[model samples]
Target: MVTRREVRLSPSNLNYEDRRCDRCFAEAANGESWPQGPFPGIFAKLDSQQRRYFTDRSTSDIDPTLPPGTLHNGGRVQSAPHAIGGVDFTIRGSMDALLRFDDGSVGVVDFKSSTASPQLGDAYRPQLAAYQWALSRPASDDPEEVSVAGLLVFAPESMVDTEQGRAYLVSTTWIP
Candidate 1:
């Protein structure tokens, strides 16, 4: 009889990495070590700042059309092991933003800064689904009923130079 082992996976693995290659995904699922390509630090910094800036703010801040909700859960969420195809797997990931609607339902939002037109749905479905699964089936913390998930796309609209330095004004759109 094969004894099943537990595996821990980050949500991004389900996104770009898993979608890109099957061998890499298998290696990751089997706990093989792999090197990630260098990502520009500026994007990380901007993401961090954006997370902070939106914390405790209303969902309207992301896009006016969203319901009245407060931003929260800007941290990590890990789920209990879930059996998938006879193997146990746990999803742990840092959420970009979590929203609590006035009615108490929760939502997850991820931020993306792009120069090109953003692609919604398919590209990010697995990643967002991982978070929703993790939140609804937590390992230690109480489970959250995730009512919605979406992407907040920030695309550059204009650039200007001021005494402080150069700045780019971005446009935000919520794709649910």
Candidate 2:
């Protein structure tokens, strides 16, 4: 005699490790693993650059008294952190960040750090797209649409792996 086990599933409660896209999910069962990448500093550099541009373009409209960092809900979204569905129902990739602008427009921004060019990886595109989709869920308190955006900040390392490194600025991609 064989015993049957009841299984439960949900987009929100899904495990990040087991989630996967259609291709991967069809090929294999859910596995335990986290998205791999460098530290957050690389992404921070790119964000700093983007903010600089925002400041420049909206110099006149931007409130001078706004706090130093992102001011949305006192940066609660960034500070506290939140996660939605994965790339698949419960099996591959997870988005890194969800950004909301001051104009009531929500957007998805993925931070990528690479020694080489960002074009070398396809993961960045789908990963960001998945994030935008998850953030755009109707039940979610998130706004209607999160303009998909990808930022690739490349930082060349020193020969000895030291903090004194060189950073090359690349163009930021925004999907409106």
Q: What lDDT would each prediction earn against the true structure?
A: 0.83, 0.39
By summed lDDT, the worst window of 10 consecutive residues in model 1 runs over: 114-123
Taking the tens digit of each residue's C-alpha lDDT, what string does model 2 give over 23-87? 44433433434455775785566666555545323312233332222322112121112334423
lDDT of 2: 0.39
**Please, what are the lDDT tens digits per residue for candidate 1 over residues 1-176?**
89998889888778764667788888877899879779999999889877778889988887787779998755898999989888899998898889998887789998888632435656787889999999899999788888999887888899999899999888877877
Q: TM-score per candidate, in order?
A: 0.90, 0.40
Candidate 2, superposed: residue stretches over 4 Å from native? 1-94, 116-118, 157-176
Q: Give the best candidate by lDDT.
A: 1
Candidate 2 clashes: the total is: 6
Q: What's the lDDT for residue 78 in model 1?
A: 94
